[model samples]
Target chain A: MEKIISLHNQHVKDWKKLLTRKQRKKTGTYLLDGWHLINEALTANVNVKSLIITSDQLEEHDDIVTRDFPIYEVTDEIMRAITDTVTPQGIAAEVELPTDQFDIPESSRGAWLFLDQVQDPGNIGTMVRTADAAGFTGVVAGSKTADLYSPKVVRSMQGSQFHLTLRHGNLDEWIELFKKQHFPIYGTQLNPEAKNFRDVAPAGSFALVMGNEGNGLSDNILSQTTSNLYIPMNGRAESLNVAVSAGILMFQLNQNIK
Target chain B: MEKIISLHNQHVKDWKKLLTRKQRKKTGTYLLDGWHLINEALTANVNVKSLIITSDQLEEHDDIVTRDFPIYEVTDEIMRAITDTVTPQGIAAEVELPTDQFDIPESSRGAWLFLDQVQDPGNIGTMVRTADAAGFTGVVAGSKTADLYSPKVVRSMQGSQFHLTLRHGNLDEWIELFKKQHFPIYGTQLNPEAKNFRDVAPAGSFALVMGNEGNGLSDNILSQTTSNLYIPMNGRAESLNVAVSAGILMFQLNQNIK
Candidate 1:
């Protein structure tokens, strides 16, 4: 833990840049706020490169804060400057970039969720947490998606991202890689041709692709998929939320995968 | 379009107050921004008591504009003051209070979704949209839930609230009303005793009660439900997002109802 007073402080400013896609591209690392998130990362065996903690929250996690590490003493104002949440939990952390999702080994089990520019951090986080509960391989966040390491994503993931294999980058290239490996990709679409999620067997060596919260899968990614499917909807509304779609698909597909 | 420069302008300030639950309740209406949402409200035939638009966007949608009411012409700066979004889409609309959910006439044709303090505005909006698409008759926001009229909720709902009967009030009393009318209520829970969603059968009328995103259904709501159901997951994840769970449950139960 290190005290960061100056917003101009080198690390504080660098971490703040993680709020933008360009900054994340340049730095290759992002910020995770809240005490529980860091703890989750720790439990996931992620290397905690650095942490900033206020004096108050430090006492509660004394076991994690040994004498070897210095706990930062920053005012609430300073902590607020570092995070975007309405109420700062008085702690923030930095962890290494996640590995590529395509690198995932042939596990011969469980559903894998693919996100194509599913932009909202909260949606990305909730998907990861839901994915974890649905017992899937992991979530792969494609390019243009929200940074999983940002405070909102970290908080929304509820520590599930740490436990799950969260990968990022070009979705097209990764889907191609999966295709070469003979992995079946299930892309979501709305059309009469799309099969109902329940009618399809969830079991497989397959990945479920969730598109952007609005526009959905680009043609390139959709073409790479083995099957384009939809959750059967009976009402007049247009579509479900991206995270919710991912959750429904995950739960349904996981059943067949098992 | 009337331009108002002052931040303290009555309507300008009232729009900002929609960010919080208290102020939205004090006044029955909430702010809905963007062209897509406003267009949906018009198409859905949702009660739109007032519409705020830039002369520019108004020029594009002559079919929906009648020039009969308070159309606030606001500078970009003033628009920012009234909207929670980075860009207010050059148009914002005031939607009337939705009291029709309570008027569902005894669940004659579709299912109902009852939320218990899910609190996140985005989640609540997703639930409303899902319930609408899943053909639910309406959605009831139980006590402690997010305000239906919050800016985020209004945006997330994407005008689906106008398509169905959506209301916020005492959930227990609503449950009693359902029982009195002999309508079945299905609550999603993780208990081993809970039947898998697909296995359960719903009558012609039903309601799916979902709990908070962080916490599962409360004991009070759970106790009142006729059956506790679960969406089976074959994987390691412990839970699904609440709205997603409701979507799955709603879809599955709606099938049985129809």
Candidate 2:
């Protein structure tokens, strides 16, 4: 195993860049922290470029070490320098970003979730995780949505990104595509004219659009939907958290659709 | 308006204690940050013990200033000391904790949510927020759940705590109470014998139990449930985030109940 103790090591500097979205996008790779995430990445057959582990963690994660990948042993201080978290998990991996362009399959009848400018990293991650659990076909992240590879988002996603299709797309273009394919697109909003979600029945194929945290679906997006649905609020809260709303709608719409 | 520039001021020292759960429990009060939450307290008629704001924030929140309460103008440094956030929102308030014990009314038919040892403050807070949005009557937080007043939790809850019934209770006792009242208590789990959530019909009165992040409901608690329901996973993700699961269940069960 390669050993490095110096915080100023050239390799450390490059690994540190994975912490930022710009660098991650430029390098086409990002860091995954903790054993659970790394294991999930391996299970999902993601392209894991290298493993970085502290001296003590090396023995604890011998199974991962057995893999034919370059393993670097770093001091605890060096691990901290490379991680964004306060307490570094003592192990991380450089994993290549998924680059496949998501295309709607010709016979696609599965549900899909489209996020519109959802800014919060945790919210974006939870939405992706929920989409995976609901067994949706994929997620189309709007341009303004939080970066899917950011550490905070990756952590919240809990490795769901690997289990399902996640790709960036212009929501307008995708909505047009779904329309051409005869798939119903549902936009979630609280408009007075919007039908309550319970009133809608699950269809074999559908696209659900969830909006930004502060605003519901954008006006242009709302104008394009086949119908708008609202999760009727019986209590005093003005609205549900965007991710929570997505979970409810995704599961409800996807239930038995397969 | 009282001006407090010195960080060592006695009143400032006392207010700082609200940052800790033990101190909050002892004082029967907790600190609420930002203009939004303080305003929510005022609008909800929650007892505002005092208002702490920096000089610049006073005019920005003039509406809150007009309320009859002891307003303190503190230095920016002092304001930071009393707040748990890095960027002190320039304003905060000491609000009395709701002391009312939640009890199921004899004729009550409204839905309720019981959280079992949900440890993450964000998850606990999100559950409470979802329960409120779903129009559930209240939330019974299990003894091992995160402190509702913790800064992380309060932030995630987004002032929904002030809009709903939130009280910690022993799950065993509450489950008994729910049973005697004839409220169907649904425990969420992945048991093969568990019914799929889609098969369950919404009833006017029900109680949904969400469990710990790492472990589902404890064996003892699971045994007492009227029925266990699982949100079927359509993909490879092991499970949904506890908060997302709670959100899906709460909205589905609450729909048409009212």
Candidate 3:
């Protein structure tokens, strides 16, 4: 087995660089920290370019070590240098980034949650997991939303990224594609003319768009949606957290599921 | 205005201690940081013991400065030392902590969300906010949940703490109290006997209990409830984020609202 003991090693430095968005984009891959996420990636048959593990964890993960993928065993120090967690989980994987979605699949026909300028990585990740749990077709993070592959988002996603189609694209184009298929595109807002979200029938095919934490959906996207719906809140809370609101909407809209 | 330019000033030193759970509990107060939260505190008529602001912000906040509470103008450096943010918003308030609920109120009759050993501060706060938005009567954080008054929880709560009653108590006692009133107690879990959540009709009064992030409801609580329920998920996700699940359940059960 190959061993890497120095932080200055080429692979060690390159893996550490995966912490940043630019580095991730430049390499077309991102680091999946900890054993749980790495295991999920392998189980999903996702492209894992390499596996990194601390010397202590190498024996327990021998199955993966015996696999065809290149495995690098390193000291705890080297493992810590490449990962952000206070207590490094002693395992990580370099997984290739899935290609961005440019077109809706002909077989795609279920709920799709759209994020418009939603900035919190945790919120973005939680919403993805919610969409996945609701049996949604996919989640499209608009250009303005947080990068889905960022470390924070990846950690909060809890391996749901491997379960569903997560893509980044222009919201306008995605909306147009859904429109061509005669799917309802629901935008969430509190405008006077907006319909109560409950009034909308449980849907088999639709797009539910959630907006930024501070400012809601952009006026341009609002104008293009088929219907603007608001979750009725009789309480004094000014608004619900964007991710929580999305979960409520997605599950409520997905009631058609038996 | 009284000026506190040194970080070592008695009051300044004491205020910084508010960041620690022990100190907050000892002082019976917690710090509210930022202009938006401070404004919300005042509007909610929450007890503001005192105000602290940097010299740069004192003029713009003259209305607050003129209020009855003691006001102190401090150096920007001191403000930074007392806050966790990369850039402190130049305003903070020391507010008295509300006493824990020892017993359910005589007139209390509505939805109540209980947190059982939920450890993440962000998730705890988000659930509190979701409960408030769902028009719940209150939320009770059981003994094992994260500290409800921590700086992270306070920030993530986004001031919804003021909108509804938030209490810290024993889940068993609270559940017993609700049962005496004949309210349905819904414990979330996926058991062979667990009913689909949709089967429960929306009601004006009920208790919904959510469990720890890694574990579902404790067996003791699950066995005691009127009925254990589960959200139907046909997708590949193993579970939903606790806060998102709480939000979905709260809104669905809150359907009784006009």
Candidate 4:
């Protein structure tokens, strides 16, 4: 056990830096702010680098204190300075970012959600959580999508990140991989001319592409899909929230649920 | 045109209070930040109490400036102080909150989303937007749910608030009204014992009730519904986000969308 009380301590400074995307990229590590997330990471056997806790929390988290990982005790103020949440949970963990390249099976079956520049961290996290609930095989977050390990995404994800394969890859490359496997690639559009989602029966092996919050799937991606689908909106709302749309489509297309 | 540049101006002090639920309830008016929401309110003929704008934006929005509404010009800093966003959109509106007590028809023949204590402003707003897209007749947010007119809810709702009837009423009263009309009331639960949502035929008229974030429907409400329903989840995620679940259930139960 190590005690670091100063706000300017090197460990505190490094943990604070993990809040930014650039720092996380440089160090290949991210911070989990509360017990719930840290507990999930430990359960999933994630490579947790260290446990950081306020002096008062050290005794309560004694279960983890005796574990193999290094533990650092800091003041409450230092804990608050390091975590992004308004109310710091007094316990945090630094986990190694997973670098495993998720593989698409030769005969890819089950739903896979591909985010095409979906930038909202909350939306991206919710969609991923929804994908996990829908029993999707994995989620491929395309370039320009919000960083999956960002603080906001991690908080909204609520530990579902541990349940499924998550990867950051080029949308085009992922689309091509699914095509190679002969899995139907489904892209969404607002146009009525696009095939209605209900009309497309759920399939075992398929990819459902959701686009950015404002602009939907890029024209290039749309042009590459097996078919573009639309959810018919009988009301006046211009469009559905990207995450909500993804949830609806993923559940609808995972035909094996029924 | 009234020009108000001082932060301490009486109107400025009063307008800033509209950000809170108490002030909005006291005045029966809420602030709509940005032109998109203002435009929607105008199009829907919602009683736009007044228009607040930055001096530079007045010329750009001449169409609105010349309209039959009181126009007040304020400094950029004043606009920022009066708005909740980090970056104010330079224009906003003070709208009279709709007080119409939406009467249920003898034959309540459309989807109505009843939210029970769904606390997140963003989730509440997103659900309203989804209900609007699903062509629901109205959204009745019961007690303990986030205030519909709170700045966060108003912002996340975009302009969909103008597209549907929104009410704050007693859930029991609403359920009784629907029951009187013989409309099925569908309550949601995560338990598998509940009827699978897919098996329930979409009806011409029904009430879809969504519950709080941490808890599903309260036992009292669940026991009162025509039948409780559950969305089958094949994956290991604990549960879906409240808004996403509402979107999936609303679309699946709408039945009218072919």
- Report the lDDT of model 4 for residue A108: 50
- Which consecutive 10 residues in model 1 chain B have the weakest lDDT in total? B100-109
Q: List-wise, what DockQ does each model earn?
A: 0.63, 0.81, 0.86, 0.90
Across A1-258, the per-residue lDDT of candidate 4 in tens digits comes to 999989999999999999999999888899998988988998999998888998788877677667898899989899889886768999999999887633444455567889998989999999989999999888888887888999989988888889988988888888888888788899999999999888876646788999989999998898999999999998899999999999888878886533
Q: Which lDDT tens digits does candidate 3 get at residues B109-171?
A: 788898999999999999998888788889988988888999999988888888888888888
Predicted complex 1: CAPRI docking category: medium
Q: Judged by lDDT relative to the true structure, which candidate is superior, 2 or 3?
A: 3
Best by TM-score: 4
Considering only the true interface residues, what is the Cα RMSD of candidate 4 after superposition?
A: 0.5
- TM-score of every model? 0.87, 0.93, 0.95, 0.96
lDDT of 1 by residue, A1-258 (tens): 566677778776776677775776666656678867776666777656567777777677666566343356566676777776668888877666665533544333446788887788878888888888877877777877766666678767777775667777577766766777687888999876888777876446678888887799888887778888887677778888887777767766777555
Task: Estimate, for each residue in A33-105, the C-alpha lDDT of model 3 and write its tens digit.
Answer: 8988988898988788888998789877677666888889998988878887778899988999886644445
**DockQ score for model 2:** 0.81
Question: Which portions of model 3 miss their true places by more than 4 Å?
Answer: A100-108, B100-107
Write model 2 residue lDDT over B104-145, tens digit each, in one string.
344445688888888999888888888888888888888887
Deviation from native of the Cα of residue A189 in model 3, angstroms: 0.5
- Candidate 3: deviation at residue B119, Å? 0.7
Candidate 3 local lDDT, residue A194: 90
Least accurate stretch of 10 residues (summed lDDT) in model 3 chain B?
Answer: B99-108
Q: What's the lDDT of the predicted structure labeled candidate 3? A: 0.86
- In order of TM-score, best first, we have 4, 3, 2, 1
Candidate 4 docks with a DockQ of 0.90
